[model samples]
Target: MADFETILERGGALILPTETVYGLFASALNEEAVKGVYQLKRRPLDKALNLNVASLEDILAFSKNQPPYLEKLYQTFLPGPLTLILEANQAVPSWVNSGMASVGFRIPSHPLTLDLIRKCGPLIGPSANLSGQASGLHFDQIQADFKGQVDGFKDDDFLTGQDSTILDLSTSKARILRQGAISKEELVSALPQLIFQD
Candidate 1:
């Protein structure tokens, strides 16, 4: 891997690939860099960004009161295409979680992107596009919009370009927020223990 962590350590942002879209990556631990991502995207503070982590252990570290079927989902769809909303613990900062008790976390499937994330630690990765625009489909597409603002860039044109399936498991009732590369039926088939709202 290319030492992408250097820029991240300096509290700078990077444009990297995910299974879905190109992502704007910054250390979730850096409040200033988190703010910089918001500024670059023209995104408002009220909306929270999702953290991109390398493992289920990272998720367990930052989250509390995890659902019973959490590991089942991890074994099934995670590291593929799925976003799980979990209750945030004290380890997660307010800047990354937006003071929300619940935060969305993703363990992206893309090999090069996941490798960099493993090297750098946790990052807040939202779509690389400016707010209100379409999800980034390729490296050049996201890079053109970001231009000189990004500290690093990693491209992968092979990504599916469909957003990950979002499943809200934070609450007592698990629900499907958005279906993307993974389907509701696919998730239900994996873990039939709980009822998933459409």
Candidate 2:
């Protein structure tokens, strides 16, 4: 935890394992740290990053005016593989959202990642692989691809190699931006109002 704290404080990023896939992580609150992720992955500036929080309270801190239906969704499927897009608060830097009004938040179910988040606060967690490449499912893949690129690597055996299901809840009409561990059918079954955008 101390090492992770030090790395993050110095505007460094980490290759951390999540339940869905290995991710390149940096403090969501730090502009430079978030930028480092973009530099490390060579990700496009136009694409936004998603944040991983320790709890619902952390999500509340970074998001504003969340709908009541989200509470139901959180109760049912948080700390799992769901990334919910909500209205961003001032605490969330514009870079994380790519200057967009909304930001995506996820509470991963992995114990180690959750504990790290508990110690380090919310983190900008995008797939560890470079932009347009397949997401790394194992630590070795991440190491081979990004050994010297990031500041540190936190290894773990991930069960699912897929990404999280991204749902845009910022608008009145809930939409699915990306399908991964959670399917659109599951979301619709869980919340009848959710609409599949893609």
What C-alpha lDDT do the candidate models reach, one value each?
A: 0.87, 0.83
Over the stretch 1-198, how does candidate 2's per-residue lDDT look in tens digits? 448778877778888788888888888889888888898788999898888888888889889989877777888898999999999988887888888899999898888778878888688888888788888676777788777778887777646887888888898777787888898778779878665444
Q: What does the lDDT read for residue 193 in candidate 2?
A: 62
The C-alpha stretches of model 2 lying farther than 4 A from their native spots are 193-198
Cand. 2 Cα-lDDT: 0.83
Listed in order, each prediction's TM-score against the native is 0.95, 0.91
The prediction achieving the highest lDDT against the true structure is 1
**Segments in model 1 whose C-alpha atoms lie over 4 Å from true places:** none
lDDT of 1 at 170: 90
Q: Candidate 2 — number of clashing residue pairs?
A: 0
Prediction 2 TM-score vs. true: 0.91
* Top model number, TM-score: 1
